[model samples]
Target chain A: MSARRIVALSGGVGGAKLADGLMRVLPQDTLTVVVNTGDDFRHLGLHISPDIDTVLYTLCGLANPETGWGRRNETWQFMQALASLGGETWFRLGDADLAMHIERTRRLDSGQKLSSIVADCAHRLGIRAEVLPMTDAPVRTRVDTTEGRLDFQDYFVRRQCAPVVSGLRYDGAARAEPVHSAVAAIRSAAAILICPSNPYLSIAPMLAVPGLRQALRDAEAPVIAVSPLINGAAVKGPTAKIMAELGLPVCAPEIARHYGDLIDGFVLDERDAALADQIDIPVCLADTLMKDIDDRERVARASLAFAERLRAEMIA
Target chain B: MSARRIVALSGGVGGAKLADGLMRVLPQDTLTVVVNTGDDFRHLGLHISPDIDTVLYTLCGLANPETGWGRRNETWQFMQALASLGGETWFRLGDADLAMHIERTRRLDSGQKLSSIVADCAHRLGIRAEVLPMTDAPVRTRVDTTEGRLDFQDYFVRRQCAPVVSGLRYDGAARAEPVHSAVAAIRSAAAILICPSNPYLSIAPMLAVPGLRQALRDAEAPVIAVSPLINGAAVKGPTAKIMAELGLPVCAPEIARHYGDLIDGFVLDERDAALADQIDIPVCLADTLMKDIDDRERVARASLAFAERLRAEMIA
Candidate 1:
């Protein structure tokens, strides 16, 4: 058998946690993370890629353990100073975290592709695992809320997801081609893992990109999704609320159904083990709440094991 | 007499200290500082106005006392993180200082004039003294060096002003009109004071503008210049070296001669009082080294007194 190469699709915090776990469990060079750039926006003349930063920070051990986003030992002096200047400070930019935005924005302005910049930044930060943006082009996730269509950051950061999400649209995603590196990673992967990020806000945007979802569906790797929801509630973000708003059942099976036939197996929290029978595909139950590095690794291992089981079943 | 409405033309640290001193002594609404914008540059996609910021920070009491530039109690986490990402770090940008750059850049991108942004920032920072850029138009200082022509920051910052100066030119200054506020300040002023800043590098750039120099020459008020030089040397910067390289004497008279016909009086440091006789204009000798806030105020007061003497002489 060929060496195990796992590809993970991730959003900001929750997905970053699982991606970090996968990096720890898998060989140094075997893990490739395709991070969502749907949350990327220009704020205060900065190209802010929230999800990509979260993933990079997580994988490189720079992530704030408490908040699960931003860099550890972060200082809010930038935001404080910005606020004093009457600058828009609704979206907090920590001093350390600002480096990424500024450097990325600079690189972007200098004509470097986002994927190449992310790859270089990851390498510089000493992350052995490859990190790629979903696409090199812009793909903003617009949340169509009762308050009208709000930009992803407007809904997520500024408004704190207060407005009821009526629908979601990935603007430019249909035209945005998946980055070649990401497509190659998916194609050659031994297994693919859909991390426990908001299915709608995070993973769906990547799926919306032209040929990205189709590539994942066509990949020979056994695909498994870790449920962001456990016991009909999201551990983080507005995944549960979005699911409820969309008139879908806020459960692991519904999450599986959301992914549909793209995933061969599903990993749910042990708390949702009763719904295993309802999941059309094979299901693995584990404690999916990644509170610590240990829990992340455990959940990561379970997801990989589930993928292996499905691979075996397919072969039989 | 008309509330001592004074207009001071300034550069970076040296000029800013005097501007701050003038602000402290004069009525809150009396002093209008016109700062050189020749040092403004776009680095890492942030529009940085070194002299304007120096004047702003110094006047607002936010300047670092030790360095005489940037914000007091500034953080360097941004630079550290930026370095790790292999971003340019030749020009050190403190974290707190970055807010000004980012905010200014954003506002500039939004089509707001630089003078308006500076005024808004000053007002927000509790600064009562009006701070105006020399012009809204781009006027970059280029140093003609032995190493060939270099951008002002490239010469001053990156190279540490090491290259032997051949000449200096203010690009676009010939067509650049002085900002309306600065012109109005100069026109209505009781006296126009030229702060003790580099003649070739700072004040010259403002003077290079089409109508700005003529405005000073034709003003109703007496124009007085405080010499940047003391005892054949500058207290800071490469002003002395540039003066010597250009085949000019590095003394108070040289500084006076450089601003000939535009000024009615020149203020020289007490150390160079021996050369006071060589100055064509009435010369006032004072301790011009602004080592502290007290020193700044004393120098500012002396400049004002000299300007008053010149004004009286003009009336006589």
Candidate 2:
């Protein structure tokens, strides 16, 4: 069959880059992106899902290339006005970005599922690839830190992620079942790819969804993951800092260790190619930091080629 | 006593203009504006008082002069995005305007009264003119039309006031008592001046609140109303069309008759000077169209002079 189904797991920005790459290389309907909702929260009475917006913006080519998130040419009038009115605008949701939140909140209030809202948004933005939330239910990533247990945005934006992370928990993950489309996409996939995103913050929350992790383990398709950590640093965000704060080694091998049996094949940065033997899973090395549109596409092509090679080896 | 007090009853846009003029002429604490809240509605799950914001924006000098409402130099990126997402953008709420709605909604949801939120907003904007809503309760102005009864905005905005008005009704006015500050200002004023706003649509709702009309009648102050129907047309909005549809003449005397015993003095346009003598109330004629800031100030000066003249006549 010509239908080559590829399911990609993603968070915001960094992960969205890989998801974009995968979408570019694969056929339109061949790709399904399951986004992390751990960073989702209600702000100003609107349900704001940060990672979902990022993935949608990235896929539709509306995301700001400079910031790697939010819409390009976005205005801060709303945030400035919000600050003037004493509204908590620490998360910096831009004016154009707010429309998405408002519409999503309205839809949710009208009893539409998060997955359906995302799918509709993606479709309206001319995105042919499916976009699905990890779960239909609310699940937040809470950082159990020395200061206290902080909500994802409270720790990330309000405190500037300065708190020392003792551990992380996907609050309500036990009750969250994977969205039917998300599960079907994974089960029907010829190959599954986990985008290079923060293990503790992004990917873990999705993996923590009860039936999700087990479904991946039981899937017929081989699961491949690209390391977010390269050498001793993350390409972006506080992934490396968080890993170090958690007393975990800040290296590619440690990223592989974090995933454990969830990953059947692993891709690491060329800088950490020498450390491949130390990683338990079979590995490939490539440049994973997607700086431009071409870079995103190349990284995606590289990941898919590497995954196919691994699948061939498994068959042999 | 250098503590001269001036009380003005107002609605949005035209009312805001007079309130702004009053703030410019009087001492900060001397002026009190009782704004109509009948236009207020919950939209996108946010409690939005259009008249309150209009007064606030005008007083802050942040109001758009061209439209006579909303913030100046506002961007519609959010509204454009909202339209793209199939959300309602008929209200033309700019991003900065959305901030006000969002903040108001947030405070309203936090168990704060509408009166307190308006006070907080006024305090934040450095407006000391005591901007108070007609009532804290939710009172929607519903127009009984040939097309059927529709919400105020739906009749005024969505349909562009094209529907013929049979009558107007204040939905919750029967149970609503006037705000204490509003009642106190009316009772304490040496003279009460109503702004040049629609008598039926804008001022009628304010009068409809239980016991407010009686309070106005009982107050020792001489009440004066600036005619919204100047000459044979409304300065702005649908007042003329509504008057014609409701079988009332589109002229200043007809406007004065609507207020009847509620007002002791009437201010009309120079074009409507001939019709002024037809009314029983004491009448003054001058340029009432606020074409510019200078016009607003000039009209305000005239209105104040007329009020003092009426006060003298009452004493005589």
Candidate 3:
């Protein structure tokens, strides 16, 4: 098969896994991951981009396999010290992981844009693929929980996701301009794949950026989304809980409907084959449970094939 | 003796030891240490007050006994990670010590004054003595070396004090305002004791601040200084090297001479008693090596008694 430029829209952990799969199956320098920066927040006075770091570590094979987040063999001395100092320690930042936040904060303070810093970090860490923040400007996700309005990190880390999330908003998304490089990547991609991340939490924030979805619509390629659930349950995080809290059924069809016409195809796990027929969009079933590198590559290949089939059908 | 408020001027390590000694010997809340901020530089975009921290750690009994710097049992994971990320790692910031820098930087960024932050930290850490930065404003020490002019930390840490010191200047001393509490502490002090810190590098920066020496002169209390040298050599750091580079002899007499008109008396180590009678104002000898806790308390008592002697003579 000929090498093609693939663009992946993703969030943290779960999404990073599929992005890793794409990196493994795809050729070098042919992948571009536009990660959601809505989860980016200031922690301990340092700029922390959770999803960007997740994807960077995943693609570079530096992520902890067990946690599926942060760096492997990480130390927690910094967090311990912070706790001892009576500082906020709910969001545990590992010592090695702190380097990312410190460097990012320093550069950001010095007027460097997030995209440039990410690019430089990627290059320095020997990441072959391009990993971009969705927007350089602040676009923090504010979770409207049953307890009241809280920042994304407050709801997720500090509250331990106990607060029932009713609604979410990307605070600065309306005014935030999409990254030029991300838009260019989408415009020229052979196919754009949305990873198995929470539809409302991750993917929607990216689409909320004005002209971002328009870039997808204007692109001369098929756009596909992978269902985040396996057997009607999310592998990790509050995806399932958030869905139930919003009074929506936790199923593949609902995720497909959430994406709607923006996607040309939707890929579900093999266990959810029955639900695939219920989705109005063109649907494909594959093994979406990416437990290992080989499993990820397999799912990535199947998803790409499904995208190619949709493109062929449109041409016919 | 009745409890009397005492003001102490200090720098780092060596000064911190004597400050700790003062804390041990004096009544609670009787001591206020005005630490030099000239060595404070923005490293990795964090506001780090080294001398201020040393004072805080020492008074609170949190300092590493061997290094006489930073918190006890500190971990270097952050420094290791920073180095791996290609960050400037010449000045090693331990994981526990990083909390101080991060918190300080955050508060400073939010427009909180350094003196207020130090006071709060000292209170939190259970330090009975007050710890104050020399000034609220930036008063950086710049060393004019044979190699060229360099920032304090750049010369002290990165260059390992190898540069031949030609001169020293406090960059913002003239424009920097003295902390109101420190000035008040000096004016109302029962006695003022200058710790065994480098004359040019440490204590000089404090004196360089306009009206600081005036406050000492205006006070009715006597002022005394402890020599950093034991015999003819400094206990640690570049005190001897800088003294030699500046064409000054490294001896207790030179240090006493440096404090000439400012000090009412001078305190030299018992080992340097042989060289003390070279036409000095008033001199006292005590154990100044400070190898252990008892040594610290002993020196503190002797220095305070010397201040009392000077006060008695002035009254007579």
Candidate 4:
């Protein structure tokens, strides 16, 4: 139990919140966060991994409290100057957060793997827990919108997610190799936690990577999921809107169903306690709305306890 | 004289100040500045042309008054974050100034010529005077120092001019073609004025270009040089230090001798009035230390008047 290796799959803000909670509660260096790299795109010739940065910044206590992405106290001088120079200003990169893209780009140019760079950054940022990118390959998330096909950032930032997201696809996922460390972490984990990130955007990209889904399916640990939605809406992002747009019920039951047979247990918000019976998986009701550090730790402890109970039931 | 078409050869701070003066005193859109691009280098994969930026910033009135480089009130959040991520920090790039590097790199990657990018930036910055790089091709200034050979920025910024200079070379200058606009400006010029910048580091790089020196040699208009040294010392940079290291007398006479047959007239500092008789070219004694806008304008007016006098004599 002291040596328990807790593995979590994450996207950006919401997922990073839970990931930070787990890192704090779990034994030092026990938590391995596999962040989705599908949100990464080349902007102004610099490779930007939005989700990876969100996770890294959160774990380091540098995440902006208001936005939940980018560094706290970040300056917009770079953005203002960039616009004046007529450079691409659609996706705004704050001065402090730009370091990740620039350093990552420089490392990638010199033939370093994305996972290694993430590991180094996490270590440097004084985070004991490991933060790994889902895959080193270029697996971009492309949304099929009513306004025609658009890149992830184009839809999310430039268009403000105004267009209806009918369908989503990971452009290079078919050939993207699951980062070896991520797959290895899953296979040896005492418990696996699916973070409260967007189902279609965040967690799906990791599942899309070859061999990753299979590794999770065969893991001996009890797999658990904390639903991103509380009641019928997400606390952040367009998860609820996108779910409705895709013709799916925007509730915890639907989210549990999305993960299907891969997860053995689910943590649903207290507000959705009545809908717990609708989920086929072993479900537990908890306050999943993580507004502060206390709430994050509470949700994390409850989810881990649920995983323990599910493991006990399986052994029986 | 309404369409005077004055052309100036420049490097960084000192040269840019004089260029700014010319821009202010001369008719709008009549001055074309041919800047040394040999100080350009690829740092962190960004193409940084230090001298070109200095001129551009100075001309646009965006240059830092304190440092004489970079933008006023620039933030260093990028540098701090970059250092935290283990990125190179020797070359201090302020956040606001980073826009030029990032935008120029993006444009260069997309197959835009260096001269065209400069023109576009000048227009966007509302610069009435044309600013052109001496050449479109990659011509890097390599310093032959006592420590060893080093790139321009490596010697200038990183080393802080600690290394003793033995010689200098402009790599790729032999095959480099002068920018068409710059060559055209020289060919159709009313007069040519050389700015008060380091002769070995700044002005020599432009002279090293294949047809530029020859064009200056063959121009029908009078070519005059404003001496960088005043009272046996440069107002800024390593001009005096490098001159002593190169076994040359640190005086206006040495600068005039360095230009030799390329210049028809020389603007000696008032302090070096005795050295004017030693110079073979037509010499005008004037105060050359430009501490403020008024000083820059005064020096610029004196140089132009000297050029006018040389032109009048040539016609007679």
The prediction achieving the highest lDDT against the true structure is 4
**DockQ of every candidate:** 0.89, 0.81, 0.63, 0.87
First chain TM-score, candidate 1: 0.98
In terms of docking quality, model 2 is high
Q: Docking quality tier of candidate 4?
A: high
A95-154 in candidate 1: lDDT tens per residue?
989989999998899999999999999999999899999999899999998999999999
What lDDT would candidate 1 get against the real structure? 0.90
How many clashing residue pairs are found in candidate 3?
Answer: 0
Badly placed stretches (over 4 Å) of model 3 are A66-68, B65-68
Candidate 3 residue lDDT tens string, A245-304: 999998889988888888999998889998877888888888888888898888889988
Structural similarity to truth (TM-score) of each candidate:
0.98, 0.97, 0.96, 0.99
CA displacement after TM-score superposition, residue B209 of candidate 2 (Å): 0.5
**lDDT preference between candidates 3 and 4, better one:** 4
iRMS values in order, in angstroms?
0.6, 0.8, 1.5, 0.7
Cα lDDT tens digits, model 2, A43-72, are 888898988999999998899878767899
Which wins on lDDT, candidate 2 or candidate 4?
A: 4
Which candidate, 3 or 4, would have the higher DockQ against the true structure? 4
- Per-model fnat list: 0.85, 0.82, 0.58, 0.83
**Sort order, lDDT high to low:** 4, 1, 3, 2
RMSD of each: 1.2, 1.7, 1.9, 1.0
Clashing pairs in 4: none
Better of 1 and 4 by DockQ: 1
* Ordered list by DockQ, greatest first: 1, 4, 2, 3
Candidate 1 lDDT tens digits, B172-281: 99999899988888888889999989999999999999788888977999999988888888889999999888998778898888888989888888998889899877
Sort by TM-score, top down from the best: 4, 1, 2, 3
**Per-residue lDDT for A280 in model 4?**
87
Error of 4 at A127 (Å): 1.0
